[model samples]
Target: MLVGDGARLAEAAGDLQELGLGPMGTTQLAYLDPPYNRGGSFNGYDDNMPRHEWLAYIEERLVAARELLAETGTIWVHLDDAEAHRVRCLLDEVFGVEAFIADLTVESNPKGRQLDRFFAGSHDRLMVYARNPDKVVLDGGIAAAVNPADFPHVDSDGVNFRLLPLRNTNKRFNPMTTPTMTYPLYGDPETGAVAVDPGPGKVEILPVFGDLTPAVWRWSRDRAVERVDELVCRTVRGRSGTRIDIYQRDRHEVGRIKKLKTIWLSQEVGSTDTARAELRAAGVDGFRTPKPEALMRRIIELSTVPDDLVVDLFAGSGTTAVAARDLGRRWVVVERNPDTVRDVILPRLGLTGS
Candidate 1:
């Protein structure tokens, strides 16, 4: 379903409720890409509004949006530096501070805009909050593409991996700071063999590997021994002389899923340039600062599953709808701009009714 009037979404919410949609807690996820309070011109909406008016407008919509969310649902609010801090405070008030999940920094522009006095602005913020954080279970182990060049080494099992230093390198990390990590390992200088005890040909290895200020190991002795098959000894020629260094083979061929980080660069997501090209390819125009479908797809995949209901209040170019459709998710999008809804969005979505 498409809503043509976004400014009065509270009224639209009532209509949806009458239709037995999102009565109290039915929506799985709500992805909002509302206008940033920047003094700029959009196609049919006013981008510049008084700070107080903008806050009040957003708060009203948030109240209605929260009502539609399920107990395990989440809301992702996308904004820029102009109102990100204010939006965060508003969300805390609406969703409770304890329900706040993450504040993700999306690098929309790789080449940042130049500023006269301040640092360049290149990223946008996405504030995520859960209806009930205690009941919300996020799938944090999302797999991302990794460059093969970073993991050039191959293990004995013919798996691509990289070797990481077993000993911690930070000077602040010492035995006093990490008592359990302070342990001894014996290694052979000639054969590159390692053990947990001093032997005839093996030299005793301490937590600190170097003669200078040393640091402790990241893992405990027992933990290291448990996965010793992944560990290996290498003889490296340092400035001092040849030294035996312990390394842990970080297998790249397995366990691709990793915890999602806070920062997402344009290379990871799609950039504004990529978004524009996608629109142009689809014969849609006059949409400035439209989000990339790939970005929307990422958000949808992370926060929802197949057939889940997704809502987008500011459906600028209908990217979210298109992404949801392609990903086998249901979506209800609202666009205040009639021209965009009729000409660009409806045509792109192949829909005739609002």
Candidate 2:
């Protein structure tokens, strides 16, 4: 379904309900790329607005959006540094703080924007929130191609592997919050055997290295015990005495799927220049900023399955619609600019009318 009136998203959603589309929890994913309120002018819409007015504008639509989302649905709001914090607060109010998800930082521009004052702006923020966090389904195991040369060590089975530190690197991992990850790991100095309990040949290992600070493990005791075969322990001679270091041997297998990270680099996701080029190739003009199809494809693949309903409220150049259709997903788009909807979106989608 394509809508030429973007301002009436709530009304459009109501119309869909009448057509037996979204009766109150039917949309699986809603991807919004609304205007950033940076005083920019597009073909038929003005992005400039006062702070309070903009917040009110977004809040009303968001209220309607919340009603259209399924119990396990997710919404991604794309914005810039201009109103991210304020928008986050609004989202919290609209969707409840418990439903809030990750604030993904997308590197839309690889080359930082040149400015005479202050630092350069290079990234845009994507706020991801779910209607019900416990029930939300996310296929985070989307892998990116890696070079074999990056992993140097060859295991006994002739598989290339890399040693990853067993200690938790994130500062947010506090023992107070997660007591299970604060336990000590006993290791044998001679042999590379590790044990959670003290034994005759095992020595108690300190979480930190000579530092009084508390150390935390990435995995809990039970998890570590379950994956003991993948663990590698080595005895290292230090100034204090002999200490055992724990490592996890990560094998480099072809076509391996890994969890997607919050930071999306421009090299992995297409940049602004790539988006412009794509629009030009599709004979689309007057749309100043368009998101690349690669970015939309990645978002769709990460959050949805084939035949899932995807909604794009700010359908600029119709990149999301095209990406969803190509990926075998159903999509509904709304564009405020009638010219863009008629000349660019419909033509690109091979449709004659809105």
TM-score of each: 0.81, 0.80
Off by over 4 Å in 1: 1-8, 11-28, 39-44, 67-73, 98-102, 109-122, 130-142, 188-202, 209-211, 240-242, 254-263, 305-307, 337-339
lDDT of candidate 1 over 175-283, digit per residue (tens): 7777777777777757667777677987766645566345688778888778767766777777656667787788886547666779987887898778999999999
Model 2 score (lDDT): 0.80
Candidates' C-alpha lDDT:
0.81, 0.80
Candidate 1 global TM-score: 0.81
Return the top candidate by lDDT. Answer: 1
RMSD of 1: 3.6
In model 2, residue pairs whose N, Cα or C atoms come closer than 3 Å (at least 3 residues apart or on different chains), thus clashing, are none
Deviation from native of the Cα of residue 323 in model 2, angstroms: 1.7
Which 10 consecutive residues of model 1 have the lowest summed lDDT?
12-21
